[model samples]
Target: MPIRYALPNDADAMAEITCAAFAEFEDFDVTREQSAANWRRNLLAEAAERPRPHHTRIAELPDGTVIGLVKGGPADPGLGLDAEILALAIHPDHQRHGHGRALLRTVAADLCADGFGSLAIRVLAVNERARRFYTSLGGVLAGEVPPGEVFYAWPELAALL
Candidate 1:
C-alpha cells in the first residue's frame, strides 16, 4: 500500500469512501446526506488552513487509485490524550486487506516519533467490528466519550511502534 498526504483533488473520492464506510453504523443519527455534507465542510476547513487541521493520509494502489484514508492529529482539548486518530476508512471493495493497518502503523509511527506517549481512537459503542480492529492493533478500551461512543487508547505507544 502506498500512503501519502491527501491532495485537494482527492476530496470527492475521499468523501464518497468515508460516507460509504460510516453509513453502515446503525447507532448514530448520521444519514448519508449528513456524512457527505460533513465531509465537504471538513475538507474545506482543512484546506483553508496553512497546515491541515488533521494529519490525513490516503492509501492508494499501485495504479494510484485511493482505497483508504486515515486522519490523525492533536487530541481534542478535553480528551487528555496526546494524539488522536480522527478517522480511518477503507473502501468496501478494499476492506479486509492490510490497508487500514498500514495506515494506522504510519500514523502511530509518526506520533510516536513526535514524542506522543498515547494515541486515542473513538468507535461507536455498537461498532464491534471497529472495536475489534482497534483492539487487534493494541487499542484498549479506556473510557466512554459522548453518547454511543467509546474511547480506545494505546496507553503504551511503544507497544504499538
Candidate 2:
C-alpha cells in the first residue's frame, strides 16, 4: 500500500482502518462517541478551522482501499505546541511492512520542515508492541499517560545541530 496524506472524503475508510487496528490490540476500548468525534474533528474539518486534524494521512492500495491512517495535532490548547499521531491504524493484512514508520516519518518530516522543534505522539501503555514501535523510533514516555497504559511520543531528535 502507498502511504500518503489522507483526504477529507476518506473518513469512512479511515474509521474502518481504525476499528480494525484497535480491535486486534489489547488496549482501551475507545468509545463510539470518541471515534465519531474523531472522524468529524479530523477528517471533516478543513485546515483553516482545525490545523491538527488536517494533518492526517492515509495508506491505500492501488484499488483505492484505505488500509492505514494517521492523525496528529497540537499538543494542547494555546501553546503553539506540536504533537503527533493522535492515532495510526493499518489493516492487519498490511502490518509489518514499514508502512507505519513511513507514515510517521512523513508527518514528522513535515513538522520538522515547519520548524516544530519537537513532535509528540500517544500510544496505549499496555500495548507493548505499540510502545516498542514508538520507542524504537525514539519516542520518550511522559507522565503515566493515564488509563494505566498510555504513553506520549517525541519522535524528532532534540535540538538540531
Candidate 2 accuracy as lDDT: 0.65
Clashing pairs in 1: none
Top model by lDDT, which number? 1
Cand. 1 TM to true fold: 0.81
Residue 132 lDDT, candidate 1, scale 0-100: 93
Taken over the whole model, the C-alpha lDDT of each candidate is 0.77, 0.65
- Residue range 32-102, candidate 2, lDDT tens digits: 45676678665546555633333677777777888777765556532224655567778888888888887
Error of 1 at 13 (Å): 0.5
> lDDT, candidate 2, residue 56?
72
Output the worst ten-in-a-row residue range by lDDT, candidate 1. 1-10
TM-score of each: 0.81, 0.78
